[model samples]
Target chain A: MEGSQYRGYGMILLGAVVSITIIRLAYVLYWIGRPLRPMPKHLSTLIVLGSGGHTAEMLRLVNVLQKDRFVPRFYIAAGTDNMSLQKARVLEDSLLENKGIGNKDIEKLAYFEQIYRSREVGQSYITSIYTTILAIVHALWLMLKFRPEVIICNGPGTCIPICLVAFILKVIGVRWSSIFYIESIARVRRLSLSGLLLYKLHLADQFYVQWPQLQRKYPRAHYVGCVM
Target chain B: MEMSGRHQSPKTENQMVFVTVGSTFFDALVKSVDSQQVKDELRKRGYTNLLIQMGRGFSIPSKSSGEDGSLAVDYFTFSPSIADYMRSASLIISHAGSGSIFETLRLGKPLIVVANEDLMDNHQIELAEVLADKKHLFCATPQTLHQTIRTMDLGSLLPYPPGEALPIAKLMNRSQNRARSSRSLLSPPRHFCSNNSPFFFVDVGFTVQQGRTGDSFLGISFSGCVLLLHTARPRLWILLLHLFQYISS
Candidate 1:
């Protein structure tokens, strides 16, 4: 009797595990396969500004995005700096590798990184001068090359330079805009949602909030949840 | 321009396509699938009129990402023909890339934007979000991307115009009218910023730092690129060095 009862319990445990696995798989399928807006007629180009996981996710969505719209040559990256988004960037790289892509074909690469500061000489400005100059030079090079249309940003630091470049492009008759993700949930990793929210306002073209409290506080924010 | 009716052939009637953005992901799917299956599926899907901008550097994909829906793909290198594709396409789904978006927008056609979170901390998301909120464009995510496509509303969408093209032309004309402000006389920007004027990138106004001998050295004002009362030695040195390099190189 004891042996039979033990077997019955084991079977129940197995059934529970199976059920959970199946449910999770179903959710994944539903999320990935469900459809919505028809792909708009393609723009001259849609430049996805960053690289890595978010980029990978963006790429995954393209399958469905291409239905009515034309899929143009797109950049699949998480962000410029690979260290922060190591995993997602790696996946993007892997996806690229799977396709056997080698290098981007451009005639030349501009290595100039320039930073312009006012005539004032402050400690913070002086300390960061070299790095700032490098960034400017790089920005100018990119400006001359990848004249983008819209710029989307999750944070201000790196995106700012790209924007400066994009703005230059705009000045020269290019069209562009910017967006922000408001990623406090993952952006401030290890920090509690409340604690991380302590900083300044979450700014963006459109703001995405994860928690209800945050949504209440920032009335204008859209609650997209933690898509990551 | 004249209107042309749909051709007798379904292939002829379909729109010719060009992908000026998002090759990174499409290439992966292309590599992972069997070429034969990809061609078959693409044909079946009625995508007889399609072009993938591989940009000359082609990458191959591994087996897994394409295991299920592996077949029905095509990839091509980006070439001058892309200009033609841009002209031909009825739709252009791009990566919100600055270059591609501007050209398409200047054309004043339709557009769909996908911000790449990969570039710099997902700034692209902000770009798409802002444009979408402004009712200038549409945005999507990988998971919900297909849905965005299936239900995409094209009526409200419009292409962006080239940024402030005519005004700057006028500014250039006015600057040309002023002899001192020729392209060569441009000093650093601080002098203009301090004066509370919208400054152009090529605005040339700098303080000439003269010494005891009344020897004048042209200097670029660094402080906010504005309010140039005096000149610093460092910029003078840089100017000299730049000249030296220019002549030597």
Candidate 2:
């Protein structure tokens, strides 16, 4: 009798779990029906940052953003050695070969935003300080020239440091800001120093994490399933 | 999908061709032949509406191949020509580079992204894997390249999954619909919560830091364009109670 009772409990638990999944799926479908409200057809342009696999993800996001009336411009941030900028440019060539995207085809701009580091151990502090100041200058350029409503970091590279400058700008006067992650969010500990930096900069404006395991570390991070 | 080596006639509307000669991982030998092989195969399979751009770092050098007996391909040394082709393609075949992925997806065009491991630490292979996992692209290996194209069906692979699409669409739509939108940055979130919800409805901002200095400039000798950085800032938003209740019950 006890065995049978235990079996019944197990069956009940499994049924509950299954039902919840179905219902949640239904709610998600419903919510999606609201239609993704588009941002202003323009913002300083949603420049996508990337190095390799991540670069593709960011670029794809840029494409999706472009479909709507409010399409953002494309920009690539150079990584570590600021080398990503040149590598990313190859992608533009790749665009020509595969997708057939031409520089003149869309109202877009492509350039590299290199990130620098100080050589001397002593210069590290000074490097950070200078980086901070340069970030501020770049922020001002973005604001004054291509003014974006919200900044979307598809690739983390320059996005992290730039976020600091943006943060400073926001504190002083800028109003809109946000940072998104294109990878999993189950564990913050595993995130690169840059990922952690971005996570902190936005402080919660909005994060589009890709996995559940990451949630344990980023309690506030939302699992959008996949941002690719 | 009628393809042509020659540009389509002007009367054609809603027409596009995919010219996917993926990136060559610094390969002088493989790249020399990849383009012509693709073009010939695609033509035989009735893919007449195709335009192609050879992979990156391959330029004026290949055209000279006509002088070589081993290099049977009529390679074009032209790199810039791809820009025109990109504008013409309704469908795109690309190497697994982030820029190609971004361009195609943003254009809302159908795509097939091939992997070129030689580019960066076999990163393209992994990149293709992630995109395939998300159902955003079609992919294949070199051995099966011809077969995949011969029996290609884009309808099934598209449209991208909603979870991914919704958030992106929301941002674009919000940007378009709101005339009040102006130059301003949204504040990073202050609270934290992790659950699958439509909260992706809000926008996630970006930052661009320039790494220019005596060291980076002297060490690298080039400015990096597409840098991948991370943000550890915590953004918190309330979870959809509906998900909790729905999952628990």
- Number of residue pairs clashing in candidate 1, backbone atoms closer than 3 angstroms, sequence gap of 3 or more or interchain: 114
How does model 1 score on DockQ? 0.02
Mark the regions of model 1 whose C-alpha exceeds 4 Å error after superposition.
A1-228, B1-12, B22-47, B55-73, B134-136, B159-162, B168-249
lDDT of 2 by residue, B32-109 (tens): 325566545655443334333544553433332222322223333236445566666655667666556755766556
lDDT of 1 by residue, A92-150 (tens): 45644655665452112111122232121233666576756666566666544443322
TM-score: which candidate is best?
2
Question: Which candidate wins on DockQ?
Answer: 2
Q: Tens digits of per-residue lDDT for model 2 on A22-72?
A: 553343323221222233333444454645545555655655554433334
lDDT tens readout by residue for model 1, B1-249: 222222113543554334445434433323322245443433443334444565433564222323253232244554545556776765555665544654565565455665554443344455456557656556764334445545555566644433322322232123223333231233352222222122233222344456576554555432112223434564665566455444433
Classified by CAPRI criteria, candidate 2 counts as incorrect
> What TM-score fits each model?
0.33, 0.41
Docking class of 1: incorrect
Candidate 1 TM-score versus the reference: 0.33
